[model samples]
Target: MSEQVIAAIDGSEFSEGVCDYAAWASLALNAPLCFVHVLDNHSAAPSEQDLSGNLHFGAREHLMEELSALDEQRAKVNREQGKLMLEAAQKRTKAKDISDSTTRQLNGTLVETLVALEKDIRLLVVGKRGETAHQASGHLGANLERVVREMHRPILMVPATFKRPEKVLIAFDGSKTARKGVEMLARSPLFAGSECHVLIVGAETAENHSQLDWALDNLREAGHQAEGAIRAGDVDEALQAYVQEHGIDLLVMGAYGHSRIRHLLVGSTTTAMLRGSHIPVLILR
Candidate 1:
């Protein structure tokens, strides 16, 4: 990993958010920024079979040539558009004083490209929805879950706009993976000055209390203004309510905590929270 913050950009409203947030993260973590635009290759491999069965040989060859020319033109146009988008995004990042930021435009599936480039990516920023996600209000990006599952890195999911985060919320469930997320937060400087509130949504069992205490103490010892609490209710509902009540600006959680928080991503809890949250969500693996 070379400390490169990769922002997955597309021709969607969320791309602007991704660009701005990526710039913020680059500044926060003192990392280089790379804006990558992966073309949506709704895709079929080319076939070299001859088409002379239905028409005369000459006519078939002419048709094939015409089709090949059209394909080439379409591909060129798509690549040019991708290039323009990358340049414009890089130019916009200058407003954040990101003059040295770089860009990359890929011609493949988004998730695969990101995963292929994962080794050098310190942090990945992306939008919740893609450009074609015009079906419903909160339609998720098609690659969201796949990226979470395939990539072994932190992902910052954002809306169509960017916000300067002040208060942060960490959803802890006492699972080993959740504790690992807590440790990552405690060690990260991305939210150095922000207030972190850790909460566990479960019965106030002795174990739960101990888990919460351990999380809070860890964060506190790491020099964070950490606060923790335990709430009872549906995990998503309780988390959404807490986020709103506390005016949390960023929501952080583990991608999938095996023991108590496995449902977070494997189930619907993580999706629900991601859909409900208006603030940025930092997902740790």
Candidate 2:
């Protein structure tokens, strides 16, 4: 019953990177890895259309039966495709020296499946852009935003390519979720040897400084080489600028907070950061 890193694969160009990143996570965290490919039934369902305009009642019934058979056949084909995708992902993970891995093909939405498996999931690894998103071009994955919002576990979103991160940035805002994120970095092996930077956006208040100091102390005490700084201006812009300026390979942050509420009300800095970030994002709950 050990916690597992669940990597969602869609057989896209991003799938290989997802597997690679998940393998790194599994090694770092000493956790088992599971590859999950969801065969989205809703998306695969055949559209209903009326074709009785030129048919008798009996003929219409026959057509309906044929359509039903076609739908069944399509579902079967999709299931086989999903299985092949999972097998390929498993092979890739095993090649990364992660032999203690498993693969599953579920029949539902990806977010829903992850939520159902939340308790056993140590971390969820997914692609920044899924198969559909990649095809659409410039659009974020349909499930990325929703998964971050709905799941209560950590999610590691891998970009198109995988790079072993050497520097890590934690976006701290003094929120409970942010504090939890700090605790995770201190306790987990995920960022073990990476140079850690804690950045707080906005005017430097005593409270904010104190919080950053406390976080840095915690990380330093945990054997992490940690540093802290305060930046002024827009949160997302400041974050993006800092990453660009500092050569950050990974960005860690709480996925939602008052910022998420703002996203609901107006726009979300969290969403913007996710959309605009050039590196992989480790989103804590």
Candidate 3:
């Protein structure tokens, strides 16, 4: 069966880049590409006011008028721009031999629409930061982490300048976090024929190295062809270099690599990877 790839396009440059990445993946996997643009009604709506106390001035009426005009303008642009984005993305992936293409303009909270569509989506490609996100926040889009936490499916976050992926890098640490990622690989026919490189970092002890090897052995047993290496360095740096050197298209790794609380306090290897790595990342928590 073919995979279903969903690209959440918000008419922002970052989101448009996400569509590009999604189209590339759809082409690579011979899957269908679904472009979704959610019109956020909640954000566009006006907040409730106390009519009992505010009967003196026409502030509420004025605010309502302004909000109505804004909503009208936003809705109009969303439909036209959304259709154009989907059409352009379709044209970009002409080589995919796509079975079909789908475009949706959903009206509701962005997360709600995406969650509702999650069951049928195999891969969800999103922008690292949306139009509203600031550069100095030291993170991705505000809703990005939330979606990753809530969505049952894997999310591939594409940076604004991301090029087409050439290879995939897998970061394994033999933990349940990593186990979830392995499970994704096990069930995913999308990656069956793709090239995968596995990296196991911080195997100081002989026993530790043995466990890493066992994980690689399990992957090989699962019918995936992977080349692996044990590296001695900071896990994030090693993975970053591997990605850069191999021209990796995607970096797959476990979220909260180790010591969740410590990670929360001082950030984790995955956080570092997000901050440093230029390629798209597939994070499994």
Q: What does the lDDT read for residue 98 in candidate 1? A: 95
lDDT of 2 by residue, 203-230 (tens): 8799989999989998999989898799
Q: Estimate TM-scores for all models.
A: 0.89, 0.91, 0.76
lDDT score of residue 148 within candidate 2: 78
Instruction: List candidate 2 segments past 4 Å from native.
Output: 256-270
lDDT of 1 by residue, 1-285 (tens): 476999998788888899989999999899999999887644533666767777865898788888788778777777888899999999999999999998888878888899999899899999887666745566565578678777888899898788888899998888777888888888787988888899899898999999999999998988899898999987788889999899999998775645444556555423677765688888887
Residue 178 in model 2: shift from native, Å? 1.7
lDDT score at residue 132, model 2, on the 0-100 scale = 75
Q: How high a TM-score does candidate 3 get?
A: 0.76
Q: In angstroms, how far off is 156's CA in candidate 3?
A: 1.2
For candidate 2, list the clashing residue pairs, or say none.
Answer: none
- What TM-score would you give candidate 2 relative to the actual structure? 0.91
Q: By summed lDDT, which 10 consecutive residues of candidate 1 come out lowest?
A: 261-270
Scored by CA lDDT, what does every candidate get?
A: 0.83, 0.82, 0.69
What C-alpha lDDT does candidate 2 achieve relative to the native structure?
Answer: 0.82
